[model samples]
Target: MDTQIVRCRECPLQGCDTFRPLSEDKLEYLESFKQGEAVFRKGEMIMSQGGKAPHLHTVLSGMLIRYRSLDDGRRQIVNFMFPGDLLGLQGAFDDDLSHSVEALIDARLCVFPRNDFHRLMGAHPRLGYDLVWLAAKEETALEGHLVSVGQRTARERVTYLAVWLLDRALATGVADDSNRLELPITQAQIADMLGLSLVHTNRTLKSLREEGLVDWAPGNLSVPDMDKACKFAQYTQIDSKRPFI
Candidate 1:
């Protein structure tokens, strides 16, 4: 397969929790990737639901959408990849991908061929632990998405997604002082992920914007105060399943 060359500096996740961090020694290894690498492409099956788990993929920049398609060809996007997120992890134990992964935009990535990745993890136990922690977090996020789709009201759905994005941005250290974050996704894509129609998604966004809870514009979103916005959605970071630490 043909791979695109990209500069390591172009990737936003140079020292994120996902991939092995770039120490001085690692820097040389990462610089090998140039800027604007294809990483992966849309419509190409990066991993199958039951495919072999070989090599791991790391997003340096851009986005990837994970989705499952029905027999009739309708696709439902399950998760969106951000900088530093790992792809092709579902088959860590077996062959075949758990879901399909495709690039939502031009992406840069560094790949650890399965054997080398395993060796790297073996040599760096912390990296191994981090990978496990990441997988657990992904599982939790999936559950949250399920709840957002199945139980949350339409207004709540909008809140759920908004707050989710806000929190994710904060985690990645990209949130601004205004607590506003810029997301360049379209309403149609949002609808597909949330299992809602485009009309409903637009209406919900408009409501939030009018209420002063959020500011929405073309390719940008600003939440003046996340505390106030979360309250509007009845949002809490607390996980209900376990006792408070």
Candidate 2:
């Protein structure tokens, strides 16, 4: 982790249509707000549940997961992060994070000191609003996930997860031109996210594959027609264009 502040204006994410643009004044302050860059290898823990994160992070590149693990050793993956996604800001209002983040692949982050969340909001209200927007967006997606786990069938659950990630990946240009995700995740991880067992997850995935809805493997997923998959999963996609700090 380097402690040198990064120039937010020059951030590559700023050039992507996936993220909202910052105003001249706001961009300048964001540059100062950044404390530096943090790089993580695949499977590295970015932050842990019940631990303090010294800095808030925005995904500069690559993929990661936010998950919560229970005492019995079961874990549920709550969310995934792509370029421009914010991380660790939930620590602002509380002492420790409710969940943990881990890199799914080699990744880079533009980090801002955790304490400055207040300064950004109190001094620069617009930037603060952006933070809330980011939080609310994640909340909305989690709500959908909750509904799926609570009521959807095993097949529907798998379909929903694939659709959810595929939609977001395409929106972020993280997926290839072929509309496929070289997802750096395993079937066991998928089971965790969908609240299913590994055996059940595998069965459902085979069914989907046979049905021609998706082609999924340990580190890859392909959705040929997202609309059809979404319809099958009864998934409502959040707008592809999203705000990020």
Best by lDDT: 2
Q: Judge candidate 1 against the unseen true structure and give its global Cα lDDT, from 0 to 1.
A: 0.64
Backbone clash count for every predicted candidate, in the order shown = 15, 0
Task: Write the residue-wise lDDT of candidate 2 on 1-245 in tens digits.
Answer: 77654578787767777777778888878767777899899999999998988888898888999999998988899988888789887777667887899999888898888776777888798778777888888888889899889999999888888988888877776876586899878999988998899999989989999998877977889977788899999988756567677
In model 1, the runs with Cα more than 4 Å from the true position are: 1-54, 173-175, 234-245
Give each model's whole-structure lDDT. 0.64, 0.84
Ten-residue stretch with the least lDDT total in model 2:
2-11
TM-score of each: 0.74, 0.95
Q: Model 2 segments beyond 4 Å from truth?
A: 3-6
> In candidate 1, where is summed lDDT lowest over 10 consecutive residues?
236-245
**Judged by lDDT against the true structure, how good is candidate 2?**
0.84
